[model samples]
Target chain A: MSTETKQKKMITDVFVEGARKGWNLGVNNIIPNVLMAFVIIHVLNITGLLALLGKLFAPIMAVFGLPGEAATVLMGSWLSMGGGVGVAVSLFNEGLLNGTHLAILAPAIYLMGSQIQYAGRLLGTADVNSRHYGILFAISILNALIAMLIMRIFV
Target chain B: MQEERKVGLVSYLALIFAIIFFSGLFAKAAGWLGVFDFTVLNGSFGKILGEGGKAFEFRGSGGSGAKDGFLFALTLVPTVMFALGVVNVVEYLGALEAARQLLTPLLRPILGIPGSAGLALIAALQSTDAGAGMTKLLYENGEIDDNERSVFAAFQFSAGGTITNFFSSGAALFTLANADGSLAVTTPMLIPLAVMFIMKVFGANVMRFYLKATSKR
Candidate 1:
């Protein structure tokens, strides 16, 4: 076989293998969870559950310059990013949020969303103490706080 | 006789984190998702949301409302699943390892970590758990040092799963824009990401400084 033929074969094989694996993982792992989040969030919004929660968080949320209802999305984010997005979509549909609102909330949610299950375990594997886990958590929030400020002044 | 192991500070904090995480789910049960009522409103609150004879109703027909929003988010399902599928393929093909060198120009000068940490960063852009798992594996294999591990972990926690967040949720900006003629999604997201990246680099360095000061190793 010619060298050109061998190179072509290798490239084709890798992409084919990679694509097959990617499809399987996405279908199995991502689809069901995303679907569940969408349904649950729709139910929550339709039932006015999120609005009720937004009221309770109104004061604290106000401090961040977001609508009271934004607390719902922020809280959802702490659980999972999917939950956050679901709530945000529902809120946007309800006309409760704007682009600026989502802009601020997006970075904040991204910063702190996965602290519970992922960071502690990751740090633990590196022999990082739990105290530092909390510190990093605080830092993530701090980053969000700063992000919010940037959004206000520049974005 | 059974030996006793005392509950430590870490466990206590972990419990707190768990409480906050789960509580976020039922924020509505606590009446937190909506300030007054997420349901149909009355009077002025209703006036603001309803606006122009358009009521905020679930499955509300027409007028760039809730039903459309739900469907718009649904549109993302295909984009997200396909993007992640590509991510899976890239990772499967060992693209991360190959791309490690390529990312060095940004990683080393900007983030202050070795170029190899790029693999963990790439793994993290899809899933936080996967990123952490890869970092743990790398640490276990002695591929990175103690300080480097801390730096990587800090970066992982901040902007972790960023691309996934952007495609799936950050695009909420797009829907919000299309609905109300507001902000664009991509550019705004890129700035936040840049900010987050700088913050992560700052965090990594801080941890590095702390480790050096404490001399724990």
Candidate 2:
């Protein structure tokens, strides 16, 4: 075959191979987390645990320049960023978050959202060892704190 | 001894050239070069970066109605799964080893991680979960030391899977829809992203060097 035919064949082959591998990955590794996160976030929201936690952490959140109610967003974020952002929207609707507040919260939320659950689930699954989970978890919170401080000072 | 030296020098040079070449190819494949700006697949299939431009509305049904996290979950779970799946394919195929090599220049000098750590970091940039998974894979394989693992996790956590955000709720960060139907994307909206990146890198290195110092002691 000509070089051109060989190149075309190679491209198609790569695409097909990539799609199959990705499919397998999705099925085996990531989909479980998707379901797990969804359920946890849903249960927390339904159980009203998030709201209570929000109230509990209200003062600390104020230090972050966030309203006490914003704690739920933080709690949800511990489960996943999606959960955090999801909570954020509800907070915005309730008027607890304006543009400035949202902007400030966005950075830190983006940074450390999904900390605890991610560490518990993926770190072990990835086989990074169980001992470091606590440390990684602490770093996630620390990172969020730093990002929030940056936003409070700058944006 | 003389012949071994000749082979080592040639192999090192060849690896350098291969890294440069493959890195370029990876960037293009990932659409970082803006070649995918106008490209559209099917509607509902999602647009490339510059395509839709600014249609991000954060008011998912999670806020608008039911006041539950369900709607957001629908969006979030699928996206996480998909990003992981795609990256996994490449990783499973062992393409990440090459991407890992290519990204070594960026991660090593800054994060003090070995070249192989690039595989996980790159995955993390796209999906924090996958990045975590990759890092775990390294540890399980005995590819990284305890200190290296700690520092690397610090980096991943702080940076927090950047491109994952870009593809998910982060797309909204780039631009927000307004009451008047016009899109608003300002520099301030993006400040957090840049700050987060810098802070993560700083955090990782601080951990890395500190650990290195203490380990030496």
Candidate 3:
């Protein structure tokens, strides 16, 4: 290879190395938390922390026509859409929620869905952090709340 | 000065439009087979396109609604999980380091971000909270300064997380376009997508302007 081409290749190699390090720093920081979040979620279910929170979020959920127990889904949605759907599935299977209720919960679930921790992982892909992420989270929550309130009024 | 080859913002916008347009055409071609039904709540492409309105009452079967919702949620899980593994593997191979080496010098001059921050910026496009956690690590380690972090944060909020937008807003765009069988190309879903895009651009520029101004002072 010509000297110029070799030089260019070296430059490319260096940048790739740097980007890899940056990615490592990000992954190392988040992996532990990701595992922990999963464990916490499962533990919450087995320990009835899920049920406890359900009662707590009940009255507020009623404003949007969701059942008192629907709070579990809301919390699940906060974790991930699938997590939230897990809650919805359980609620449906238990005969506590109908398809319509799941439908009502859909938009809000989409809106403020991924809680801060998971959202952090997503934002991390682009190298963003907590304080800035908090602002977006706050905005998303407000959007979801208002949307649910409107859905209650219209639907 | 030579023109840069990086895709322009207009190209990104066009990509969004093109995806919706093609998805609609594909759906219509499928409809001709009488094999796939496209039913949204309260209305279908026929009523929605012909009348130019939204349905006020529930019209579809409830079971299908839940089924569809579950299916949509299901699709998202694998995408996220796969991203997690891919990110790890990429890190293991030092791909981000190459990206940082190539882009940081450019971004430092143009975007004013340090080379060390490149990976976090890319991750932010996937998820904000996780990106923040990564950025925090860089800051704590003194790899990036506060000003760089602030600017990076703003830029991320603006246009990152394309994955979510692809499924959520992008799916909506395709749904509306396909409703009419020939890509009517207009729908309520367009409003949110446009708003988010605008917010991302304007938000990033606003952040950059502030950081630059402060740096001079």
CA error at residue A149 for candidate 3, angstroms? 2.8
Interface DockQ per candidate: 0.17, 0.24, 0.07
Q: Which one is best on TM-score?
A: 1
In model 1, state the lDDT of residue A75.
69
Best-to-worst lDDT order? 1, 2, 3
Candidates in order, TM-scores: namely 0.63, 0.58, 0.39
Candidate 3 recovers a fraction of native contacts equal to 0.06
lDDT of 3 by residue, A57-87 (tens): 7788888887777776666666664355445
User: Which residue segments of model 3 deviate by more than 4 Å?
Assistant: A1-56, A119-137, A150-155, B1-217
Instruction: Provide the lowest-lDDT 10-residue window in model 2 chain A.
Output: A29-38
RMSD in angstroms, all models? 15.0, 9.5, 12.9
What stretches of model 2 exceed 4 Å from their correct place?
Answer: A1-59, B1-103, B128-143, B157-160, B173-190, B213-217
lDDT of 1 by residue, B10-66 (tens): 434433432232222332345343332211011111112465765442333452433
Q: List TM-scores of chain B, every candidate.
A: 0.52, 0.50, 0.47
Scored against the native two-chain complex, candidate 1 gets a DockQ of 0.17
Give the best candidate by DockQ: 2
lDDT of model 3, residue B124: 56
Candidate 1 runs further than 4 Å off: A1-56, A124-127, B1-72, B81-112, B126-130, B141-143, B172-188, B212-217
Docking class of 3: incorrect
TM accuracy, model 1: 0.63
User: Which rank order by TM-score, best down to worst?
Assistant: 1, 2, 3
Q: Which wins on TM-score, candidate 2 or candidate 3?
A: 2
